[model samples]
Target: MTEPANIPSDALTTDVLIRHRREIVDLKQRIKNRRLQVLGLYGTPIVILAALITWAGLKVFVWLHSNTPDAIDNITGFVVFFSGVTFAVQAVAEFSKELSTRRDRKTPVRELKLELSLAEERHVLEARRRTPPPMDRQASYKERLPGEIARLRKESRHYRRIHLFMQWMLFINSAAISAVTAWYDPPQPAKGVLICLGFIVTLITAAAGYFKPRERAFNLQLTADSIEQNATALELGISPYDAVEEKRNLALFATTVEDLRAEQRMREQQLDQPQQGQQGQQEVI
Candidate 1:
């Protein structure tokens, strides 16, 4: 899209950036929804199979302990027959419908992703071209602080959510393994499955430890809070920002904010670094 001839460069760039960003976001959401739909479509059969397997396992356990195996035989047979029929009917209907209509109804995910990437690139270019020189440091800070704080908090929330999800997965997997081992002697297949789950839990634990999302979240939040506090103190003429001269107060505020940001960047770098690198840095420090 071409910018209007009448519009100023900065305004035009800002408008283009905003529009492209919105388009990118919308494209991403659409891609996510389409992927979810595809996953659900393919996953239904696997879920059905898992349920059948679990039911069969339970029945096997019952059969081993109970004398009336024949009593449940008809029920089992009926359930299996019904499940098979349902699976066949649903699969045929859904697969046929999807195969027939998918291409016509939806944009392909790859195309959407390509579109998103192009939009993002356009956004970056527009952003680069639209850099307006700040009239003053205080004005710049006043304009930037709120957006910076919001961005930091949003990122913090995202990382915190991931950390919480991984933690909960670890907890649930650990509990499942413990309950299986302590309460019941499961069959060989179940034991193998438990082993796989334990391996998954270990991998998740290692990932959580390595990436340290919780620590990242904490650092981001701390930095955001510090920045916000300094901004507030500067506004209210409080301690550290209570200097007589307005320029001095603004300079101090800018320095403090910059220092906090630098510290946050350092912390983020440490988190991203390998343990050996971090240890070496610590030794140097």
Candidate 2:
């Protein structure tokens, strides 16, 4: 709950400020990447679906115009076509949200990470005492990091539920379009066309629904190992320096670093609680 105060505002005038600016630039770049991801993930598929549905409609239009004798009266047919489009768009919307969740978060997270590295250094220096514990360096994680992951996983699951519902809505709309258009003109060329397009959308939506996103269980073992390693290294009088500054997968590391800081605060609170209690008991005596 305590606000960060160690880094002086004047430090921003130093090289770290330059790095922070670059990070902000990268944050903007990442936002652009997300925009493109959304477009590709949603726009491309929607366009393809539109094209296929249009193809079916065009065939019907050609047939109706060619042999309608006097007039081409097929209002219900086009209604079915647009209904399919609407349904497809809704499904796309759902999928787009799912894609966004997997890609959002950049600015504040980066700064939080920079702060985390500094905290790790200070933590190591403050813990200097014994022998360093062997840690699995590759898979280090913080407890709070897992909580963030869980929150995202929950969001993904909710998005998937909405996606499934949207898919089902499309399926129902497609079926209705096929049935109604066919009833209006059983021998019409558009009947088979609508039915075929309906089946295709149905298949696509079904496939999309079959795959759902999930979260990983937090690795407590990795967390314990990381903490023990830091503590042991401290015991041997090792100065914490460059290890945690690792920008390798900055997003992941930043979130982990924040979690580590949160864990530290909790530990500090626990340590202070007993002291506070002992002081009160002494005063009573």
Candidate 3:
């Protein structure tokens, strides 16, 4: 009998890797099914809208070619009526989808996802348990903090760019649409469609403001920077970190980082509360 030579103790065993790989494949399939479920849930209104648009469009086309004033006026009326109905229906559908997604956050599907995440974490822990503990685990952990900080910063920048893009879209499109409508003074049917478009854009802008993705990204970046400062101070033997022992310093860093994350979550909840209150009030009305 002989021990296997040249095998890294830290490397994962074939069986463990295969098991985790299967779990990952299963998780991916579950995610795809969840997406299909969402489409099935939210797609009905869109399908209805498409059918109405097709019917209305054909009527308008036929009436335009007929060159009858009465038919044209009828077409205009249909455009206005359908536009309003479409907005109402779309708004309701979107609100329902949002509520459904929020509810689903705590549903069994999401629980299964959380379980999968836990399993992956357990796999990592098992692998670590099998490996001889590194002599400088604390130092290695400290060394990784800068990379984590960079990752968070990059994500924040990405979100900021998206925020800027959305702002530009709202401003530019609103201006362009308004200018074109006023200058051209398009026919009643076209004008109604343009108005509907403007309304849609306004709704999108309002939704973006409510969600405030950019603000969340900024907060995450700030937290990462705070953690990075602490990590750097410890590494450089500066200030408060200078007096703390190695193990205690690592514990303090971890605790502080968790506290920062908790604070960020609290702020997010506070921001969401007003939006939820407004929604509730709207429902009451």
Candidate 4:
């Protein structure tokens, strides 16, 4: 009777940690979906209420301009009354449904978060127990580099998109205001509202300038690209890694990657500081 080959404890621990990590990810996604559901449930009524109020306002405006103002007033009053009552009923129903859902759910959001936290802690503990060889550690770190690169690029893309959207909004608002003022005679109240919108666009422009999303996106992309270039060079055993021995090359690659990440963090911190603070720091330096 030949004995089956025994699996390495390190491999078994790695496998367990991988599975546990997947479970944690699933829990996090579930929590996110549940929160979104709650938001939509409550938010729909508020959106409906806003739309109804806007419709009522437009009706009132038309009634004020109509010849049969009293009859229109009676109709508007009934519409407004029914709309308010409907909104209240819908709001109460949504609240009750949310409450009932909370009561019925076996694992609520808070419990799921707690479970996720515990799972993360267990993963950390298990990872700490297994001591990987130096080469294995280097390989593991290298494997994680791609994920980090992807995350940075994703953030860069997000910021870039936001910057573009804000710019377009500013342009469209300015053009609309110009066209309306040049060609159409609006009521005093409507003119005032348009002016307010212009002010809002100005504020939006100021905010975008202050936050510098475009610059942030550029910095993130640059950092990600630098890291990727170094990683590729290290993997292909070219340039910097070419002259070094295998273990030394791995160690150097790890150090270089870490230094790049630290520099990226520093850049992010600098970007986060206010202009005045940055100027003061520069003066001190």
| Clash tally, candidates in order | 0, 4, 0, 0
lDDT of 4 at 63: 52
- Per-residue lDDT over 241-273 for candidate 3, one digit per residue giving the tens place of the 0 to 100 score: 776576666666666766876877776675577
Q: Write the per-residue lDDT of candidate 2 for residues 1-285, one digit (tens) a residue.
A: 233452453343334545655655665666566565455445755665666666567658776466532322354345446656755664555456554354343334455456556655544453343212223232334334455444544554565666666667677778767576767755476766676677767776754534321111123233444544554443343545234533333334444455664664544444345556747755876
Q: For this target, which candidate reaches the highest TM-score against the unseen true structure?
A: 4
Question: Ranking under TM-score, best-scoring first?
Answer: 4, 1, 3, 2
Alpha-carbon lDDT of model 2: 0.50
lDDT by candidate, in order shown: 0.80, 0.50, 0.68, 0.78
The candidate with the higher TM-score, 2 or 4, is 4
Model 1 worst lDDT window (10 residues): 98-107
lDDT for each residue of candidate 4 in 89-154, tens digit (9 for 90 to 100): 544544565544343134467887898899999888877876677987997898899999999999
TM-score, every prediction = 0.54, 0.26, 0.50, 0.63
Q: Give per-residue CA lDDT, model 1, range 175-238, as digits (tens).
A: 8988777766555557876898799899999999999999999999999999999999989999
In candidate 1, residue 193 scores what lDDT? 65
